[model samples]
Structure formats: structure tokens, C-alpha cells
Target: MSAKESGRNVVAGIGVRGWLRFIWRQLTSMSVALMLLMLLAIAAIPGSVIPQKMSNPQGYARYIEANPDRVAWMEKLQLFDVYTSVWFSAVYILLFVSLIGCILPRIRVHYRALRNPPPRAPKNLLRLPAHAQASGVTRDDEEMRRRAVGWLRRSKRYRVICDDEPGGALVVRAERGYARETGNLIFHIALVGLLVSVAIGQLYHYRGQVILVQGRGFANAQVDYDSFSAGSAFDPASMCPFRMTLDQFDAKFRVSDAQAQDFTAHVTIDDNATSSKEQIKVNHPLIIGGAKIYLQGNGYAPEVEVKDADGEVAFAGAVPFIAQDNVYTSLGTIKVPDVTSGDQIGLVGYLLPSAEQSESGAWKSVYPDLLDPVLVLTVWRGDLGLDNGIPQNVYELDTDNMTQVAKDGKVVTLVVRPGETVDLPDDLGSFTFNGVKRYVALDLRHDPSLTMVLIASIAAVIGLAMSLFIPRRRMWVRIAGAVASVGGLAKTEDENLQREVRSLAEYIAAPDKAPPVGPGQAIQEGKAE
Candidate 1:
């Protein structure tokens, strides 16, 4: 045939319908489903290794800052958002569809098999894998058939059916272990449920973090959190109407090595007119109103009162300091933007919990406890960047347009202890170190699909156990004038099938006292004809 004619004939043979059928068959096959499942797992690896924007924004920012050139390419590939990426979603959707397609047909077939009866006994039973025969039985054919059928049903729990042969013989066909297929189907169905639950959770869950100083209150609102991330479908109005106050916070550290021993945050929660006091600790979360509040971290917030040159208080609140070392050496920023004196004043400083002057004349914290707390600060005068309409980090002070306070052509530093006040240079202001209060960083998470996920996980485990341990097998028993035959077949390789058949044959021969025989052994010396 000519090349063009051959191509035309091939196209005619396999049209659009044939091509679609072939694709559907391949996509719905068990092998394809398993491969897709594996591919989904592989796709999740990038989400773990790379910093995800939704889960770890700080880490993602750091990664972008460190690898500025790669950020564009990585974002284009959706590496930072692996779970929500188009490729990952496509794999997930394909796996879901494949599992459903593969399971539905198997379920239909299994259902039909459940409604149908066991197959008829074969003509030659000796050809089976496990077979046994007995001759010279004293019982009548009717009694033998009755006893065999009754024993198979009552003792072995097999679904049995008996029929009369044409030549005064009886045949009993029995089968059991339909639960194997049932469990297999249940396992696949549970997998689909788990996938759906996870998808819902990824679409509607919300998580946020907040830092609360002692004696401060916080409400459950999107605007209250310092950092918040939520699924695309999450709504701010759905948040529970709850309020919490940090009444107190406590921390303990080892004396010798300054290792942190424990941390606890005491808080009062008010939800919908109900009020309760609770203590939150690491790993132990407070669950309320379908949300869980976890104590993520703890630090110290130094209470300070900043006054302008006119002695009017400009800033009076606790400023949280990020801990820099195990000894509680912390860094903080205090911005006095509303000062009515000179230019806007900013104070950048470190808090040393247990102050100790080093050999180099630098102050550092020798211990985590408040042995000799001191604030070491540097004053600045500038615009404070408040009127620029640009959002800034509360813990960071922008010093680009600021001039450091100088004394005799050298930058001046101020050291203030608790209850002590230090004056600023150039008559900017004065700041008093009142005291220190403990603070706690809390993370609240709400996932409405958690219950469904937990239930589906448990069901999947049970179904898998059932499918693995259960055995499917069939047994047949035939009785003639004074002889009987028994045979068994296992869906899989079961070593006990021969023993069961032999036991059945022996029981038919002698109901009260059956002969003991090894597995796969015939009761009689000659094979049945």
C-alpha cells in the first residue's frame, strides 16, 4: 500500500471515539491511579523543602532576599506555592478521578457477585489444588449431604448451596470472604474522602499569630493579628466573637547554664458571654470556639514612659523586644512620633536582663533572669517616617533620614536602670525605664475540615487492615451412594486450603471422630474417578 493510503486507513480505523476510549481506559486503570498517587506525593516534596508564602512568610522573604535573582523564576514555576500550583492541582484532580473510576466498576462487579450464588461444582474434583475423597461411608447420601452442608455453614461460615445431581448424587458449592473485596473498595473510597477533606481544609482554613503583653487584651479579628494567612475561601466575618487577655506570663530558666526550663501564659477568654481563665504552654494548646490557641513563643516587653522636653508624656506603653541570645539580651525600637518638642525622636536600644559589663566596656546579659536589668539606648532625631504613608515594621526603626545624637563629636549612649530616667541630647526628650513585663506570642488556627480528615484517616486504616488480613476462598463437596469428595480453591495462595478440605472429607466420613491427616493429603489410597 502507498504511504498516504496506509496513513488514511490507520486514521479511519482509529477515529475520535476510538482514541477517546483508549485514553479513558488508560487513565482509569489501576496502574495509572497508583502512578498518579505517587506523583502527587512527589509533588508535595517541594512544598516542604521550599519556604511557602502562606505558611512561612518570614522565611519566604528571607529566601527572596538571599536569592534575589532566582525569585522571579521560582515564582513563575510556583515553587513557593507548590500545593496550589496548577501542575500539582492537575495531578491531584487526575488522581481523584482515576480512583473514582477504578473503584466504581469494581464496586458494581462486587455487588453483582454478592447477589449471585457460588459456582456449581466441577465434574472432576480431583483436578483442583486441594482435594480429598472418602469411600465406604456408612451414612446415606442424603444424610452425608446434609451433614456436609450444615458443617460448612455452621462451622466454617461459608455461603453454601446444595443441588441434586442427575444420578442420585448431591453437590454443595460454598464460598466466603466477600469482605476482602468489600474492604478493598472501602480503602479506595476512604482515600477519596481523605483527598476531599484535605482540599476543603486547604481552601477554607485560617491561621494567624499575635503577640500579647501582660495585662493587654486582644479580640478575634483579622485586623488584630500581627501576621495572618488564610485560604482563598476564608471569610473574616466567620471568625468567632472571642476576646482574650494576657493576665500574666511566667518563665523559668536553669541557673547554671541559663537553659530555659518552662514558660506559661495565663489568659482569660470571653466567648459569647462565657468567661474562663486558662493557662497556655508549649505543646499544650487551648481549644475554644472551633479554634486552637497555641503559645508559640515568649519574650520580654520593656515598659517605658517617654516624655518630651516639656515633660508631657509622648509614649507610654510596653515595647516588645526580640530576644537575641539565651541570656535574654534583646533588641527593641521605641519611636516617639507625637512629641511636641523638637524633631520626632526615635530610640533604638538593647535590653540586658542581667546586666554585666564586659572587659571591653560593653554591657551584656549574664543571665536570663532579672538580676540587674538595664536599657542601653541610642537616641535619634528625624522625621520618624510616619507621614510617608508607607507601612513599617513596629520592631524596626528606619534611620535613613535620622541623625544620631552626638556629644563632643561622638555618638552618645544612655544607660538607664529600672525606675531611672535618662535625658536625651539636644533637648529632644527623656525616657524612663519603668519595669519589664513578660509577653507571649500566640498562634491561632481554625480548620473546619479537621474532623472529616481525622475520620477519613481512621477509616482508611481499618479498611487497609481488613483488606490485608481477610482471605477469599471457595469449597465444594459431593456425595454419592457411600462416598464423598471435597475440594477447595483459594483466590490467593493460602496454605491452609488443603487442610480445610481434608478436614471436611474426614468429617463427612466420620462425623464424631474424624481421622487426622496432613494438609494436601487424600483420605483414600486411590484417586476419585
Candidate 2:
């Protein structure tokens, strides 16, 4: 290789190394840390605004169906799953690395500083921020120095050092408040710990929700939940071994507008080795087997019995109704896919707890309580498209291929109250409204690192308090011949240093009596020079 080519290669390597160092320094700067934190916060907005598929599959699906044109773009941006998105994870991971790089070196420097004493007394004490001079404390230099050191030691406030100057004057250097620096380091370290705790908690967490009607039971298994979501490192087999049976659900409402006041679920739990009963209410959860169960909602489920044309019972169970208003006006759908005689049937309509007729001949609900409950259903009969193996929304009925059953040249309408039976049109079937039962929604969650997160939060709070409240300062007392000079300096601009210097001079001048004047007045007069 020629010498010019070799020199060019060397210069290129040096350029690359220097560029990398610059990048590292910028990443670890406090400005970058604040920016990354703000970016992380901005990135989390989509998680709350858009429904996540892992938590609400039905709602998410409906959203996609409503915006068919945006699905591809939204998927590419990972808006549906913001917390687990690759870009979000990268941002937080980089923040964690930056904090580590910034805090570790500060901790090392602060540790070394604590082991060393304060610097020697300055040469020109008159040039300090606050200086005080006292005469006639003692005629001998040795006696004045002894009294000053004795007074500083008795106060027990500063780290004192006594040394001899070139002119045979005694110089005493004292410093305190190393804890100020230590606290600053600790605050940064705690921030790093908080980030670690949150990351670990996210990795090992799992949450699932289930809806159980009165007299229904649930097992803590993956298949038993209506919807379950797990972390990236979560193991399904590690689920808590427990079973819950809901005995009763009670909902209380206010007198006006039927606003809900409280909801409580009475449940019995079995952990295979023991059994216990607990009442779970809003904001108060039941903790068992490292998992917490919370009560989120309550609604009414209408029980019904259906029979085909042959009089054989086809369906008998309670169907949960989704509430649409504060007065418990609910919407529900019932599909009978296994009828033995004729085409399958589907029923769709609203369940009114307090049924009322409007002036325009429309039926509506008047109250949340079941004062006079009624079911107004529209009947359809045809192919339900159930055999295609595609999942269908349980709450919605697809009637694209169904024929509406009518009676006397009008569309058929079945109105049934509690314990009422009505015959279907075209001799299709018979339907009866049995009764109404209450149901409660429960969420179970577990995270192994929650304790660490709590500890880190407490540490961060304490470090923050110390870093803000503690002060860093230095003071020096020098005795030359019969005169004593004191000077003070503080890390921050405040009046405490001036006050402290004047007080020390007074204390040395009058060991058993109060000084004649205040520290502030003395400092002002001295500054006139």
C-alpha cells in the first residue's frame, strides 16, 4: 500500500471513533433523558385512545370493521398494541441505559470526595463572600487559635482541620454537607432502580377478566376466562390454583336517575386444600394464591326457555345483556342453532327493566331498577351461517340471509314479561321469559415484582427530599497575632453563609456572653469597607 492510502485509512478510523464518543456523550446528557421521558409519555397516548386487541378483542374488531381503510396503516404503526410495540420498548430501554451511564460515574466521584477533607483555608480571607474580623479575643496567637478550635469542636457541626500558615498563623478549615452530594447520587440511582422494576413487572405480569352470573362458578384456567392477556415472559402453566363460585350480587342505586351507588359480589373460593368466602366490592379486591380479583361491573342477565315446533326444549339458560344506559336499558341477542324441527332462529332486541310507552308509541326504559321488566324482541328465521367455523360476536346477530317472521301482514313482535310465554309465528317455536339474575365482572391480575416497585418508589421519594433540603457549605477561621478572621462560602447564593461567619466571630470573642449586635448588621457595616 502507498503511504498516502495508509494515512487516509488512519484518518478515517480516527473520525469514526470520535463520532462514536460524541454520540455517547449526548445520549447520557440530562437533556436527552428528559426528552426520552417525554417521548415515552407521548407514545403511550394511543394505548388509551385506541382499543387494544389483547384486552378488548370485540371492541377492537368493531373498530377495525368501522375503519377498514386504516387497518393496514394502524397495524404498521402498532397503534393497537402500544405497550408491547417495538419502538416503545426501544425508547424505554435506551432511557434505562442512559441513566446507568450518567449515574454510575457520579456515584464514584462523590464517594471519593467524602473520604477527603475540605480544602485548606484560603490565603486571602478578606476576598471571600462573607468575612468577619474580631480583635481583643486574646492577645496571644496560640491562645486565640486554641479557643477558636475548641468552640468549633464543641458545636459539632463541621469537619475541622487545624494547620500552620507560612506567617505562623493558625488556619482552621471546616466543611460539612457531604450528604448533599450523596443525596444527589442516590436520587439518580433510585431513578434507575425504578425503571428496572417497572420493566421486570411488565415482563412477568398477567391479567384476565371473566363474567359470572349468580350461582355460576369459575376456575383459574386459561380456557375458563372470557378474555385473558399475558406478558411476553409469562407462562400459562404457572396460573394460580384456585376456584371461585359467585353466590350473589347486589347493586344499590340512588333515588334520582337511578344512579348506581354501590356493587358487591359475594363469592366462595376453593384452593383445593382450603375453602373460604369473601365479599369483593369496587376498589376492594380479594387476594388469593398470589392473584387479586377485582369487581369491575354488574348487570342483569335474563333467563329464557325455548322450545321447537315438536315441543322439545331447545335452550334454557341466562343470557347476559350489555347495558346501554344508566337506567339499565340493555341490548341482547339469542341464537338457537340446534333446533331439531325447522330453520334456525335468532332474536334481537332490548330488555327494559322499567318499561314505559312514549307519546309517539315507542317503548323505552324509565328506571334502572326492575320495577316492571319487559322484553321486546324482533324474530328472524333462516340460515345463521354457524357451520362455517368463523367466530361470531355473541352479542350481535347477523341477519343478512334471514327472513323476518311476520303475522297478519305485519312484522312479528314478541312482548314478554317475567314468567310469560308467547307462541312464535309460522309455527316455528315457543319462547318464555323465565326470570332475571345479576352478574358481576371480575378481573384477576398477578405481578411478581410489585414489591420491588414499591420499594424503589419509596427510595426515590427519600432521595429527592434530601437532595432538595440539604445544603453544601464551607467555613474557615484563621488567627494572626491578636486578630481572628473568619470567612465562609456556600454552593448556593444565600444569606446563611454571612450569618454563620458573623456568629462564629462573636462566639469566639465572647465565649460566655451574647454578642452586642446581630450578625446581619455586623456584616453590613463590615461590607462598607
Task: Please give, for residues 1-529, the per-residue lDDT of candidate 2 as tens digits.
Answer: 8868777643445488888999999999988988998998998899989998776677787798789999999999999988889998999998988888788778889888788888988887878888888765534677666767776667746778889988888888888777877877778888888888888877888899999999999999989998888778888888888889999888889987688899889999888779898899999999887888999888889999989999988888999898999999999998988899788998888899999988996889989888988999999999887786545788888787799898788888888999999998889889999999888889999987788888888888888888777777888888875578888888876567777778777766653555544333232214313
**Best-fitting candidate, scored by lDDT:** 1
Q: Whose TM-score is greatest here?
A: 2
| Total backbone collisions for each predicted model | 0, 0
Cand. 1 TM to true fold: 0.84
The residue ranges of model 2 lying beyond 4 angstroms of the native Cα positions read 1-17, 49-53, 63-81, 138-156, 356-367, 383-392, 399-411, 515-529
Q: Where does candidate 1 clash, by residue pair? A: none
lDDT at 190 for candidate 1? 94
**CA deviation > 4 Å runs, candidate 1:** 1-11, 45-82, 252-262, 307-314, 324-327, 335-350, 356-367, 376-414, 424-428, 511-529
lDDT of 1 at 229: 88
Worst 10-residue lDDT window, candidate 2? 520-529
